[model samples]
Target: MRAQRKGPRRRRALITGSLGALVFALLTVNILLGSYTVTIPDFLAMLGGRTIPGASFIVMETKLPQALLGLLAGASFGVAGAIFQSMLRNPLASPDIIGISYGASATAVAAVVLFGVRGAGVSVAAIIGALVVALLITVLARGRGGTGLILIGIGAAAFMQAAVTFLLSRADLRNAQDAMVWLSGSLNSANWERVAILAVALLFLLPLTAAGSHQLHGLTLGDDTASGLGFNVPRARLLLTIVGVLLAALPTAAAGPIAFVAFLSGPIAKRLNGGVASLHLAALVGAAIVLAANFAAVNAIPGISLPVGVVTGALGAPFLLWLLISSNRANQGG
Candidate 1:
């Protein structure tokens, strides 16, 4: 028994260490590979608070904040994704895939294009939108099961997409361009302020997520089983869902919906950790994905810089399709 327990712990440690190293390496590469290159010496110097002429401004103001946001937002999305996937007992039930991110996006876009809202106002609008959509899904899927929730979310996403399109069509050229860039999840607008907002939000949400994660594990055993074990199944589900929505909303507000970071992170982490659920590992994986994707977007294709979402969408779409086909076949088999 001791040996078996130690074996899983050792594996979990190895996985966590690997993910942490990957995130650190990606973060280093992201900070180092911008328009104006900052050498290792210069990076060290900047870290030590010694300005290295032109490099300091670029590194400190531009690359630093961008890398930080990617790390923070990616972790937020990853943890959030893990919560939803674990709670719903379906890998396809991620915030981005279903409709939570879309809910935030639709409202933020409307605020930007229709009411000319920006900055903090837009963030607030996004939070409201996410909460509203979550509530709607819960109500609609009452007693229906995970499949029902997923189907309802997909429908809500379609409606949100249409609303975003209509709002964009009504806006002027300049506003439309801004809206499009945001919708595509560009890191070009990243700054210390935005990073701070996400960081602060995480500081609050993460503890709640941590506490709720235990309940999440109980949930994986099914509601009746969990209830028999003395858990309030419905209350636990509601708390976890709310935490997941907030996690999804904050990042969407900070960096736009950023494609499938939320959708991809949990499965990738689960795969890496040998099918064991580790929210910490998932968060790290999420950060790595966003940071790596952003690095590729900016540097991989020479001369043409793409939005982070474009790259993520390109990667996630195929996976989404495969999941759909597999699920369909499984249903048919059943």
Candidate 2:
């Protein structure tokens, strides 16, 4: 018994620690290795209030903010995606796959194109859009089964996507370009302000996620089972759904829906951690994906620093098709 318990604990710790270290290394590289390289000693000196000529500005102002935002946004997307997938028992139920991210994107685009909204207003619009879509999905799917909910969410995603397209077409050239760039999700606009907002949001959401995590776990056992285990199924689901929506939305606001990090993170983490829906692992995987993808985007091509979304989208689309194929085959077999 002791051995059994220790084995899983040790394994979990190993996976967690290894991923944590990888994320740290990637972050360090992002901060220190760019067009201008800053040595560790100089980095430490910068932290200690001594400024190097070009290194200080590049590392402190550019790389650090971008890397931090990527980490936070990636973790947020991962946690939200994990919550939705685990609770709904559907891989396609991720906020990105469903309407939540689409809603946020659509609203943000509209705000940019139509209302000339930028900066934090776009973020607020995104959160509102996600919440509205969540409510719409829930209300519409109240009596319908899981399939109905998924379908509705997909439909919503499609509609909002169309909305974004139409708005982009109507906008002037300048607004269109700016909106398109933002929608493509670059870390170029990252700064201390966005990082701070996202961090504080995460700090606030953490306790809420922890408080409801117990109920979330219970929920995976089915509504009846969860109720028998003393969870109020409706409340738990609502709490988690809200949590998931906010998690997905806030990151989208900060990073412009960085293309499938949320969708990819949960399953990747679960596979990595031996079939457990580990949120922390998912968060780490999310951070790693964004960091690595951004690194590649910056250095992968000559004369162009592609947006982070481009790389993630290129990676995620194939995996998504694979998932759909696998799920279809499983259904046929079953």
Candidate 3:
């Protein structure tokens, strides 16, 4: 039996690793192949600290930063999804499902339209808004069932959606159109400075995730059990909530809440790895999905570009509905 289990595990590891490598290589090629094709030799020489004037600026300005955003956003969404699913003990408890992205989007849009805030200020507002909604959901669901929390999150998300609709209705036509674009995610206009900001967040969050891995494992048990295990359950939860909100918020701020990457990454990783629980695997899968999706979004069609959010939503919405249906059936049978 052990040998049989080991065989499947080895196969899964090999498959997951192959998938990750292929995704990364494809993303690299896509990044280099856009608009002006920078040959492999020139691209390497440019990165190796030798100046190929136009190539250096193009690499520095365009591909490098966007690639970094894709990486950071993908990793953040992936890890956040894993943490949320584990904490809520529900596969459907991802931030996207719980309306974390909606909260961020609502607040950022409010900032842009009502307050005229831009740049880092928009990001900060989105973070604050997401935290507020997350707290409300947590507080309202305290001492209640996990299903209660899920329901409350849905309500919060709906409220955010309404708010966005209201804002769009009130705005002028051009502004409304622009708002529509943001309501869906886009990474096309990202700059090097945005990349720098996301990198800083990753620098902090990745190490923090490493240190908190043990706590996350404890969380897979019931709260009481986790508390009994010497984990500060409330504090740990608070930290996780903050991490998740920021993870969702930062990307929303930069890329406009690309939907469903956060929702899909954990499950896809689990499925691909045959139920492995490694956060690293989840991150890898998340990065692969985002980069791969972006590559398709950028190059899949001519004369028109689909946003990353659109591609993810196209895939995520149907899957999310299926999940909801499956959960309902299981509950009925139980």
Which has the greatest lDDT?
A: 1
Please write out the lDDT profile of model 3 over residues 1-334, one tens digit for every residue.
9999899779877976887796678668656886657888887887788888787887767777777788778878888888888777788888888888888888888888888787888889888888888888989998887889988999989989999999989887877887788778877767877777877877888888877778888888979999898999888887877887787788888878888888888888778766755677788877787787777787788766678788888889999999989988988995
lDDT of 3: 0.81
Residue-level lDDT for 306 in candidate 2:
88
Ranking by lDDT: 1, 2, 3
User: Which parts of model 1 have CA positions greater than 4 angstroms off?
Assistant: none
How well is each residue in 274-295 modelled by candidate 1, as lDDT tens digits?
8877799889989999999999
Q: What local lDDT does model 2 show for residue 199?
A: 97
**Relative to the true structure, how large is the alpha-carbon lDDT of every model?**
0.91, 0.90, 0.81
Runs in model 2 deviating more than 4 A are none
lDDT of 2 by residue, 192-214 (tens): 99999999999999899989888
List the candidates' TM-scores in order. 0.97, 0.97, 0.90
Please give the RMSD to the true structure for each candidate, in Å. Answer: 1.4, 1.2, 2.6
By TM-score rank, best first, the candidates go 2, 1, 3
The window of 10 residues in a row where model 3 has the poorest summed lDDT is: 272-281
Between prediction 1 and prediction 3, the one with superior lDDT is: 1
